[model samples]
Structures are given as structure tokens and as C-alpha cells.
Target: MRAWSGQWRPGEGFGEPLPAWDGPSTLVLVFASPAVIADDTPPDPGGPLAGLLEAYPASVVMGCSTAGEILGGTIDDATVSVAVAQFASTRLRLLTGPIGGGTDSAAVGRDLAARLVAAEPDLAGVFVLSDGLRANGAQLAQGLSDGCAGTAVITGGLAGDGDRFDHTWVLVDGRPRTGMVSVLGLSGPHVRVGHGAGGGWSILGPERLVTRAEGNVVHELDGQPALTLYRSYLGDRMGDTAASTLMFPLSVRAPEGRQGAVVRTVQALDESAQSLVFTGDVPQGSIARLLRANTGELVDGAGEAVRRADLVPGLPTLALVVSCVGRRAVLGQRTEDELEMVMSRLPADVHLAGFYSYGEISPIGEHTSGLLNQTLTVTTIQETAA
Candidate 1:
């Protein structure tokens, strides 16, 4: 397998250089800003991305707009990061579909997973990218696992719309649209995939009970309005809901299960409902707490995830890092610290492509992959002869 990665800047124009290779690319992944390609400013099928699409017209193209582009060891804003994969021994099956606002996330995931498995039961792994805001990350993972039925490994992330928390886009084939989910399945006897996820935020105070909740919305905590409880901690920072609340995300864990805690960021404040919305589910009766990041530890956590992945020996054909936007929020200009740490642990020859997502997706320990916030998730892939 072979891979090529490059960045496209707005003012740079399409005339700028792009990834160049001899053979045909099997898959094309793009992560750009919403401004670059949205339903409103529909990209000309023959526009900036034309060169890439033309180069590999047969390639399964999948990608989404991101909060920021993860290019190698740097975190870039207002840029497009592209990666093209040309596989020799591995085969890829592309599954593109719509995800209705009220559609059952598990059903969508199950359908996608079932379709891929039916087509190729020996599927090595599946990578997914969905509408971050409209879809339930947890339900989708559950559905994917159910469909795969422990037959394949699944990993991916939810598309991000910067910090605006409004209007995210996903690119299927060469067209970009909202309310769509795309999956790329890698199968055959040669594909070898490995993944790891970790969060560095430390728990604050004592764990509280999630007294009431609906899906991803938390109505109350410890028998009180969730927002009211959150503000009690924010104090002066309460006014700026968008940025300030990100510093202290909710740490959640199932009450009875031995599963690890997953941190969730406050997506929005529902004044009328008097609740807090998160990227994924916050089950009622679960244990919850506020988490604050220790910058140094956060960087260490990124490294830890890379070390844990134990990627295939030699060099990975592709390395994709899906990290949380909250990590970028806490790290600010220093956000590169996490990316740098993750990159340092990989072989220099591996093709790197990543993005800061609204929410990450990956399994933790014995658990199946799930939607996660404020965590760094790494996926590495390679192919060897059967």
C-alpha cells in the first residue's frame, strides 16, 4: 500500500500542488473547514478538488469539515488536509448514506455494517464519519457492533463544525452535503488495523449522580437542573457558554458496569429546558463529575494513546488521528503539543492525516468502540500478504 498527504489553503488556489503518485488511489480522505465546501457554496465537481477526484475517479472519497486540520505535527486552522491511499493487497468497499435528524442511529450503523459484512465477511476494519451534531455517537457504535456481530473492528469519529456547533458537512464521493454519513470498509486477508484512545482530563471534586437525562441531554444532576449545577461551578465564566464551559467537561461512567469513564463536553445550554447538551449520551443514574485538563498530562495522554495502539511493525500505510475539539480549546495555540506527541511515536514513513473532531470514536479496554469527547483516538493501518 502507498499513501500521499498534502494541505490546501484558501488563497493558495487549486493551481497549487497536490499529492502526486504513479498508481491509482483506492481511497481519498479530506478534512477541511466548512467555508471551503458546504451546501451553500457547493464545490464545483470540477473545482479545487477536481485534480484529486480526477486523479482517482474510482476512489471512494469520504471526509468532513473539521474544527481544525491535523497536518502532521501541526494543528492548522482554515486549511484542507488531504490523504490518498493506494492499496495493492487490500480491497475497500465504500458505503455512503443519509442520516435523518430523528433516524435511529443504531439502525443506520447496523445497516451500514451489515451491508459491508454481507459483501465481505472477512472485513478487517471499518472507519466511519457521520454528522456529529444530528447523530447519536453511542447508538451508532452500538449498532455497528451489533451488525458486525464481533466480526470486524470499527473505528472513526463524528464530523466537527468548528466551535459554531451549527451546520456540519460530510463529503461522499466528490459531493459535500449535510445530514449524511459515510463509511469506508477495508477487507480482504491483507489489511491489518490497530487503534487506541485516551483522555488526559482529571476528575474534579466527587462523582455525582445523573438524576435525570434524555439521550444526550442532561436534565438534572444530583436531583437539580444540570445547567444550574454546572453554573455553580463556572461562576464568573458562566456568561460565555461556548468557550468557558469547554474547559470543564463532564466525566461520565455507567453506574453498574466496569467500563471506563468517558468525558463529555457541554455542546449547548437549553435555557427553556434548563439542561445541558453533550456530544453523546449521558445515561440517567450514571456517575458524573467535572474534569479539568492538566496541559502536560494531556500531552502525555496523547503519547499514551499512540503507545497503546502498538501499530503494525515496520511502518503504517496510513495513520489517522481523531482528537477532540475540547483538547484544542484547553491547549489553545499550544494544541500542537498533543499532535506532536502523537506524531513523535509513529514511524516517520507513515502517512499522517487527522482532524480535531466534535467527538472521537474508539473502544476503551474491553468495551466496544463508542462516541467520546475530549479524547485522542488514533487509527493505524497496514497490509501484509496472506
Candidate 2:
């Protein structure tokens, strides 16, 4: 396998374009900050990506705007990270289609999953990137589980709009577009892929019973309005729930197996109904607990994610890091510390690429992949000797 990574600034131009490769190029991922994509100044994004696409026209290109981009070991803002790869023995296929705004998440996932199998029946794994603001990540993952039928490893995340969370873009065939889900399918006998998720947030206060909820919206918790309970915890920061509550996500333990509680960030507050909306589903009877994390714990969590992925000692052909934007919110100026910690555990030669997402998509236990928040999800890919 041959892989190359480069960084691009708004005016600095793309540092290095994808190198010319004779064989089939597997994939090209572009992670950029919102500022970079919205920049109107010189060296527009089109010119840089245009040149690369002309070179590797056959490569499947997909990505999204990020809170901060992970380019190798450095976490960058107001910049773009470009990673192109050519797998030695893996066959790659790309599928992308429209996802109706706030609706049809499961249908879209099922469609993508079916198309993936049709495209390559022996598909080994799948990576997804979708609109962060308008997609129901939990439903989409479930639909994928149903369609895949335990055949392929499903992983990826929802695109982020930085801290603003107003809008997000997903790259489909090198073009940035909204309300679209891009799925990349990897198939072949020699492709080795490993993934893991880690969120080192500590539970605060007792686990309150979710008294009333529907899908991802919780109307009440412990016999009180969900919003009221959330406000009680925030106190002075009640008015700024969008940004202030990122550090204090809800740790929800569903009314099922001992799979551990999955973290859920409060996406919005429905003041009229005194409800709280989350990025994923919060069953009516789930146990919801407040969660908090410090800078050190966040960084340590990233390292643990790296360890959990269990990558080979040397270097993988490509490594993608999908972390939650909430982690960035809490870390603030020290956000890069977490990325640095993850990089410290990887070999310098690994072609690393990723972004901060609204919700991470990876398996929480041994079976199905799930939509998670405040977690660092790592997926490493390499072509092992045939």
C-alpha cells in the first residue's frame, strides 16, 4: 500500500497534492475546519482538491468539515488535512445519497448498507460520514445493523460544524454538500481493520431514572422535567446550554444488558415542553447520570482509545480518528492535548486522518456498532501480507 498526507491552509495552498500512483487508489479523505471551507480568500478549496482529483480520479473521496482536523500528530484549526491512499490488495467502493433533513435516517442507512453489499458482496468493513446537524445518528446505526446482518464492521461518525453546530458539510466525490451520507466500503482478503471507542468521563451525581422520553428526546427524568434537572446542574450557565453543557453530557444506561452506559450530549433544550434533545436515543427507562471530565482525563481517554484499537506495533497504512466535538469544547485551548496523546502511541509512519464529530459511530461492546458522544473512536486500516 502507498499513502501520503498533507496539510492545506486557506492561502498557503495545498502543501502537497496526491502523488501519482499507477494502480487503483483506494481512498482519499479530506478533513477541514469550518473556517477553511467557508474561506473566500485566495487559494480556494476548489483549486487544491481539483488538482488532486484530476490525478487520482478513480479514488473514492469523502470527508467533512470538522471542529479540528487531525493531521498526523498535530491537531489543526482553520486548516485542511488531505490523506490519499492506494491499497495493495484491497478493493474499495463508495456509496453516497441524500438523507432527508431530520427524517429518514434509518432508511438512508439501510439503503447505504444494501447498496454496499450490492457493490461488493464480500465487503469487509464500512466507514461513514454524514451531516451532523440534521441526522439521527442512532437510528442510522440501527438501520445499518439490520441491513448488514452482522456481516461487515460498521464504523464512522457524523460531521461537525465546530462549536456553532448550526451547519455541517460532507464531502462526496470531492465536493462539499449538506444532507448527504457518504459510505466507504473496503473489501479484500488481505485488508486488516481494527476499531475501538473510549470516553474517560466520570459520572457525577446519582443515576436518575428517565421517567418520560421518546426516541432521542427526554421529557422527564426522575419525575421532573428533563430541562429543569439539567438547568439545576448548570446553575449560572443555564442560558448557554449549547456551549456550556458540552462538558456535562448524560451517561445513559439503557434498560438492557450490562453493556455499560453510553454518553449522550444534550443537543438542544425544548423550553416549551421542558424536554432535552440528545444526539442519540435515550430510552424511557434508561438510567441517566451527569458526566464530567477534566483536561487530563480527556487526553488520557484518547490514549486509551489508541490502546484499545490495538494497532500493529509498526504503522498502519491509514488510521482515522473520529472524536466528539464535546471533548474539544471542554478541553478548549488544550484540545490538541488529546490528539497529541493519541499520536504519541502511534508510529510516525502511520498516515493519520480524522475530525471531531457530533456523534461517534463505533461498537461499544463485542457485537453491534453504535452512535456515541464524548468518545474518541479510532479505526486503523492496513493491508496485511497475503
Candidate 3:
């Protein structure tokens, strides 16, 4: 596989000229800042995206807006980071569908998986990008897993609108759009995909029982108003519920004979109803506890994720690092430390491109995939033989 990556800014444009590939690329992944996606100005005919599509008409171009873009070992907020890869003897397919509402997220995911699997019986892996605020990430991940039927490994993340949580966009073949989900299917025996996820957060305070909940919203915990109990923990920071809650995400563990514990970050807050909206599901009867972490632990978690990915040495690989936006917020000025740690642990020839997302999607076990929050997830793609 051959790969190339570059960054483009508003006035400066791309840092360097586009590469001259031998032929059309198999995949072109574009991670742009929310500013770029929210721009209302007319599209420039000679812009970077247009130039890319014109150059590789046969390629599958897909990505989404991010809280922050990751390129190489650097992290930037207002730039567009792109990675183009050309694979040998690996087949690719792209599928997209509308996520009408949060309630319909599961169905959309199941339908997309079914279509991809039906078209490519040997589908080896899938990378998904969906509207962060509009879809229930937990349900979407579960639906995709059910539809795949243990035939493929799935990984990716939900689109982010920085900390605003107002709007998010996903790009399919053309321009960015809201209320959409896109998946890239990989097939063929030569394609080898490796994925790993880790979060270095420790539980704090006492565990509470989830008494009332609907989808991703927690109405009550331990028979008390969810927001009421959450505010008690925040104290002074309660003024900014959305941002403050990120510092202390919830650690939820399902009932017996179900998936393991997963983190959940606040997406919104209902002051009047005293409810808290999480990035993923917080099922009733699950045990929940607050979580906290430090910079060293978070950075170490990134290294652990790289270790879990088990990337082969001395191979041309593309490492897609999808980390939680909450981690970026917590890391503050030291955010790049995690990215640098990831780069240090990867193979010398690995090309890294990714973004800070609202929620992460990765397999937690051999046959189980789940939505994760406040964690770093790595997905590596390499061609073993061609």
C-alpha cells in the first residue's frame, strides 16, 4: 500500500502540493475542523477537496468534522487533515444512509451493515462515521455488530462539533451533510486490520444504580434526579454543565451476562427536567460511577492502546487514532503529548491520521463492539500479502 497525507488551511491552502500517485487511490479520508465544515462561503473550484476528487475520481472519499484534527504527530484545530491510501489487491466499498433521528440510529446501522455484507460476503472490516449529536452511538454500534454476524471488525467514531454540541457533519462522496452515516467496507484476504481501545480513568465516589433512563438520557440515578446528583459532585463547576461534566464522565457496567463496563460523557443537560444526556446509552439497572484521570494516565492510556493494536513491525500501515474529545479538553495545552506518545509507540513506517471525536467505536472483545467515551481507540490497516 502507498499513502500520502497533507494539511490545508484557510489563507495558506495546503502546506505542500498534492502528490502524484501512480493511479487512483483506494480511500481518501478527510478530517476537517468544525470551522471548515460550518463555512457558508461558496466552494472554490480549485480548492483542496475539489482537487482531490478530480485527481482520484475512483477513490472512496469520506470523513467528518472534528473537535480537533490529528496529522502525523501534531494536533491542530482549524485545519483540514487528509490521508490518501492506495492498496494492492484489496477491494473497497462505501455505503451511506440517513440517520433520521436518534431513535433510528440502530436501524440505519443494521441496514448499512446488511447492505455491505450482502454485497461483499468476505467483508473483512468496516470504518464508520456518523453524526455525533443526532445518533445514539451505543445503539448504532450494537446494531452494526448484530448485522455483521461476526464476519468483520468494525471501528471509527462519531463526528464532533468541538464543545458546542450544536451541529456535526459527515462527508460521503461529496460535500459534508448533517443527519447522515457513512461506512467504508474493506475486503480481500490481503487486507489485515487491527484495533484496540483503552481509557485510563478511575472510578470516583460511590456507585449508583440507574433507576430511570431512556436511550442515552439518564433521568434518575439511585432514585434521585440525575442532574441533581451530578451537580452535587461538580460543586463550583456546576455553572457549565456540558463542559464540566466531561471532566468526570460516568462509568457504566451492564447487568450480568452482558457487555462490560464503558465510559459515558455528557452530551447535553436538561435543567428543567433534571436529566443528563450522555454520549452513549446508560441503561436502567446498570451500575454507574464517576471517573477521573490525570495527564500522565491519559498519555499512558494512548501508549496502551498502541500496544493492544499489535501493529506488525516493518510494514506499511495506516493507523487511525480516534480519541475522545473530552480527553483533549482535559489535556488542555498538553493535548499533543498523547499524540506524540502514540507516534513513539507505532512502527517507523506507519502513517497516522485521525481526529478527536464525540464518541469512539471499537471492539471490546473478540465478538463484541461497543461505543466508548473518554478513551483512545486505534485502528491499524495493513496489507499482509498481495
* lDDT score for candidate 2 against the true structure: 0.80
- Per-residue lDDT, model 3, residue 324, is 90
**Candidate 1 residue pairs that clash:** none
Off by over 4 Å in 1: 11-25, 40-42, 233-242, 270-274, 365-367
TM-score of 1: 0.91
Q: Which stretches of candidate 3 lie over 4 Å from their true place?
A: 22-25, 38-42, 231-240
lDDT of each: 0.81, 0.80, 0.85
Candidate 2 residue-wise lDDT, 253-307, digit = tens: 7667555678998888888998998878998988889988888888888898878
For model 1, residues 328-359, the per-residue Cα lDDT tens digits are 88888779988889889988887888898888
Model 1, 291: alpha-carbon shift in Å? 1.4
TM-score of each: 0.91, 0.91, 0.93
Q: Rank the candidates by lDDT, best first.
A: 3, 1, 2
**Residue 200 lDDT (model 3):** 83
Cα-based lDDT at residue 23, candidate 2? 45
